[model samples]
Target: MNEREILTNYVYKMVASLMQNGVEDVVISPGSRSTPLAYAFASTKNISIYRQVDERSAAYFALGIAKAKAKPVVLLCTSGTAAANYYPAIVEAKYARVPLIVITADRPHELREVGAPQAINQISLYGERVKWSAEFPIPDDAPMTLPYVERHIARGVSIATTAPFGPVHFNVPFREPLLIDFQEELPKQTFRNSLVGQIAPSQQAKELLTAVINETQRGFIIVGELALGTDLQQMWAFIRKLKWPVLVESLSNLRTNVPEDCGQYIVSTYDALLKSSIFKQQVAADTVIRFGAQPVSKFLTNFLTETLPTNYIVIDEDPMFRDSAAVSTHFIHTAIGEWISELSIENTVFSEEYLLKWRTSEELAAKHIQSYQEIEQDEGAVVRFLIENLPDNSDLFVSSSMPIRDIDTFLLPTKKDIQVFANRGANGIDGVMSTAIGFSEARKEREMYLLIGDLAFLHDVNALIATRYQPCKLNIIVFNNDGGGIFSYLAQSTVKEYYEDLFGTPTALSFADVAQMYEMEYMGIEDFKEVNKIMEPQKNPLRLIEIFTDRQQNVASHRKLWQRIQQELEQ
Candidate 1:
């Protein structure tokens, strides 16, 4: 085979291998260096390609797609800074345990450290943020590199999909004849499945569990972000039978029909919950049973560490904990589902006094919700409107800082099918809007609702630009509070002089102008009552609905809600 034929065959085989291995999506950022890989991926019918010009946005876009689909997604970018731009998403994938395959084209080894354009140490660009990294050396002769390139690509995919799955890097270096177009049929390669089998719990795990149940009167079960295929029903059944106070994070998949009166167990990741002395007291337990991934909020971690349980049993398929302060007394190395199944057969139950206290605390929280400004004609009200009006079967992607915090506290979705997503990996507000757009594109059939703050919405304004692919009907509701509304509730908001300059910096730009620039439909609402009226149904492209609120009032309203809840609890 000629040089062109070898390169073409290599690219075809790699793409084919990825598709066959269950990777269905690829986010490609256009550039000359990666032209061959991009063309090969695009021409392949089995894989879906999303075109994003900005590498940073493209990486996050791929992150969103992977996160939503619960599958490994590939990100294609050119060498140099274009590849470096994937660092943020890489860190997020590592921390959040999302599977991402990063593919970057590079210059041949001969050109390295010689000041060649777009050439830098491509190896380990992501440092320790990724699970694995490899440099595919260029062939001395084009034909020799084909098999090596094909093998490494397949290996990278496997490493990413394995347990405690995370992002993986593949740096492919090509020489002068980068543009290769050979129609020759490429031979396919099959990859060996190297699955990570779980180790059965040692005698120590069982002994530890027995000691905790014997010693502690009050035990709490807390579940965080679990993997997609997790058996939630089995776990829930175990907890319900025990009548234990179970605190569940939004992503835990355990936030189901557990009665509010069960206890002061359902913790909130919002401002009101943060200030609740009562809620804090309720969480002070003798023991805690932790399952799944880490919670997104810093407050929750602080609370867990400060109110240290005598024995904290952490159950996870992957034994690693991303949060530094999370110290486990007992680490069960088996799958959480398996552990719960075994525990359920034993028929364990907690003290009635312990269960009653939690139920009372939940009553306090419920009363608090009823007292909070009734979600009317303001920021709080807008959140309430969404909770009530969000269409059935719609997926909600909330922006960090304000939107997610609010939803976690106030807006509880009525339906279990309405999945909620956010960039809690890093909690950065930069690419939130764009990430939601990518999510909408990935799940093209379902309608997506994105709730964002004004500042976050403006950060990725360019993401709203048109693409060749048909735009997903993404309904975006922008809380136009004119600045970072969240800062007003934080301690930093007290610094009157620097508050607006640093934290609450308002852009003073109009969403209407942005809509015109992007050629998207726009709706502006001054009153919260108009939220439902404006957010009805829409077709194609994208729709932006802006709601205005007073920064001062939003803070006050949230405060009042907490106060009301406290009063109800006392009564």
Candidate 2:
């Protein structure tokens, strides 16, 4: 066979293997080197090709798609800096456990170390940033070459979508005259992946957890950032079976669509409640059961650290050493729902008073929040209005930094079933817009919203390019505080000398111009009541609703709100 057949055979098998392993979407970064791979992906059946010029945005877009669908999304980029640009998103995908198969086309082996242009040692390019990385050889005279390529594709997808799933890298070096022969239908090749069953908790582990659960009346089940497609019903059922208070993070997506009685145990206002010294002192947790990643609240983190619990247990399916407080008595790595199911104990009387205490605390803080909402038009009200106005069965992607905290604080538990997402893995502000763009692509029918700060919005503003081609109904609510508003709430704010120039890092960008440049409809508003205009999508699908806010005023308002909550809780 000629180079055409060899390349065609190899690339076709790779694409088929990806599809066989349930890869529905492929994000393509257009370049000369990746032509063959791009053409093959486009030619395939039941596959989507989202062309993105920026590799960073493309990688994050793939992350968003994989995250939303709970499936592996493939990213194709040419070698050199195009692949390097994926580093940030790769890091995010690894920590976030979002499955992404990053494929980079590289120069052939003969061109290595000879000062070849567009070639810079592509072997294991992503290093430890990816779960698995290897150099995929060009299709040649090797025996079983087609099968080998197909098998490796299967393996990579498996590794990516397994327990503690993450991004996997594949660097394929191609010679000149890269094959783009998709005119004639190539012979179909497919590989079946071995079933990856859920790893249940060991009997001994179950017995111990059950024993702890039996005695745990004053326990708290803390749910952090859960994996994508996590069943809220199962989480709620587990909470019900244990009858323990569960402090839920917004990203867990377990806080909403809860039953009416869920408010009794579901602790959404723990961020606010833990701020009160009196409430924190009164709320005692002996056996602390934890799941997912760390909580969003710094105050809650402090509470956990200060009050050392006897049985501090953490059950994570995506096993990682996330114990920041260094107080985990037993770290059981298994599926949380499975662990809860296997527990021998039913609901027993631990401390009804403890749950009552939490419920009352949440109510008090919520009351203050409500009263504050009625009086002020701060970020909390901004977030509150956004959450309250969301259509049923929608997706909300809140950016990191202030937006994440704002959503967590204001997103009350409701029956609306709003799915929330955030890049809390690395928790960086970069790629916020791109990730949301990709998320909207994956969930095409759902009403999508993005709550981002100005810096984050500008970081990946080029992501709006994807919307120009792949249009989706995305309501981007960019809270333009003119700069890093979150810094004002941190210790760096005390150093006023270098704060504004360094930490403040204000980018007084006019997002209206950005909207016009990107050809997206723009709306600017100040009054929180104007949020009522946020309604069903009409003529324009891609629109930016920019709300200008003051950084200093935001800090003052947040501290004042926290003080009021603490004062009321102390009463």
Candidate 3:
């Protein structure tokens, strides 16, 4: 076959491999260098291709799709700076553990690094942000280059989808014959599934668990974010059979069907307990069972570190503990769900005193949430409204800064099955809006909601541009408090001039203008009562609802809410 024929065949095979490997979404940014790959991807009827002219937005849109789908999503961009624009989303994916497959068309090896136009060090451009990176060389004299490229593409997709999944980069170096007709009979490419790695619980893990099973009179299991969707029912059954206390984080979907009022189960993240000295005295665990990824709160991290349990077993699919403070006394590499299913523990009665104490704590937390003020124009009220009126079965995606922290502290989802996702890995607010948009796209059937601040929304406004996939029914509730409200609430705000200019640079851009620009439906509500009225029925595709508030008042409201909680605890 001629060079053009071989290249065309290779493109066709790669697209076919991606489709076969369950890649249903593709985002393409217009550029010259990537025409062949773009054309090939567009031709695949089974795969959905979204067209985005802005490379930065396109990359984030793809990131959103992957995050929502919990599957690999492909991003195609031309060589040069177009490829470089994907860095933010790549970093987000790396930290968030979202699977994004980035395919960039590039100039050949000969044209690189010599001040060549549109040629930079494309290899490893993402640094440690990507899981794997490879540059595919154009074959000049190979008799059977089509099959080789096809095989590599299949492997690359597999590697990208494997556990501890993140972004993957493939730089295709194409020469002058980039523009080719699509009339060749493409060769078939075989898809191979990569094997996932597994590690058995260490000897220390076995010994630790055995000791806990023997001596510990009271046991508690605390499940954090990224730790749900496992067979939590079995874990629930196992713990309940032992009459052990189980504290489920809002993000940990394990609390499904387990009533918050259940004596042995407490729902909130021990937020109320953190306020009182009685918390330290009453809530002491002989053994603490921790499963899943790290929790989202600094307070929780501090509590876990300071009140170290006699025995702590960290059960995680990923062996690495992201938490520096709470290094696991025993690390279990197996899935929490799998371990719960395998363990055959008899119905052992726990001391009623431990369960009674936890139930009292639960009552205290419930009272705190009930007494939380309902006044509008404050952060506490905003959160209270969200927790009360969040649509049933709605997937909630929160921004990194204050929004998530407030949600963690104040808003506890009444519906236990609601799926909550946040980009806490790196915890940067750069791609939050785009990531939420991507998440909505992946979950098209369900209602997806994003509670973001103005700064985070402004950071990725380009993401609102046209998307190719079926746009998700997204209800974006933006807390337009002008600037970085979180920073003002922190100690850094005490610095007068520096805090005003450097930290709180409130841009006066109107959300109405942005909504008009994107042609999305917009609603600006100043009254808190109107929030539920507007958010009642969500529209398909996209809708932006801006909730206006004063930054100073929001911060004060948060403080007052905490003070109220402390008062209730003391009483």
User: What tens digits encode model 1's per-residue C-alpha lDDT throughout 1-571?
Assistant: 6777666776777787677667899999888888778878878775788888878878888888888887899999888899988887788788777889999999888888899998888888898899899887663445556566666766777778766778999888877687768443435665544344544577677666756765667777777777645666677656655556676776664544444443234543333443566666765778887777666556667777878778888876676754457656777766655555454223244566766666666655755564454553467767766765666677888998878777777644233456677887677888787788877877877768899999888887756652435355688889988899988988998879888989889878668987776667788888655667655767435788888878999888877776766665555
Ranking, TM-score, top scorer first: 2, 3, 1
**Predictions in order: lDDT:** 0.73, 0.84, 0.72
Clashes of each: 8, 1, 2
| Best-matching candidate per lDDT | 2
Q: Least lDDT summed over 10 consecutive residues: which range in candidate 1? A: 262-271
TM-score of 2: 0.97
lDDT of 2: 0.84
Which regions of candidate 1 are displaced past 4 Å? Answer: 139-144, 182-186, 190-203, 256-274, 278-283, 296-302, 323-327, 344-349, 370-376, 413-416, 466-470
lDDT digits (tens) for residues 458-507 of candidate 3: 88787776543344467788888888898877789887867868888889
Show the lowest summed lDDT stretch of 10 residues, model 2.
183-192
lDDT of 1: 0.73
Alpha-carbon error at 461 in model 3, in Å?
0.6
Which portions of model 3 show Cα errors greater than 4 Å? 139-144, 183-186, 190-207, 227-243, 255-264, 346-349, 373-377, 467-472, 538-541
- Residue pairs clashing in model 1 are 262-359, 263-358, 263-359, 264-358, 264-362, 368-565, 375-381, 376-381
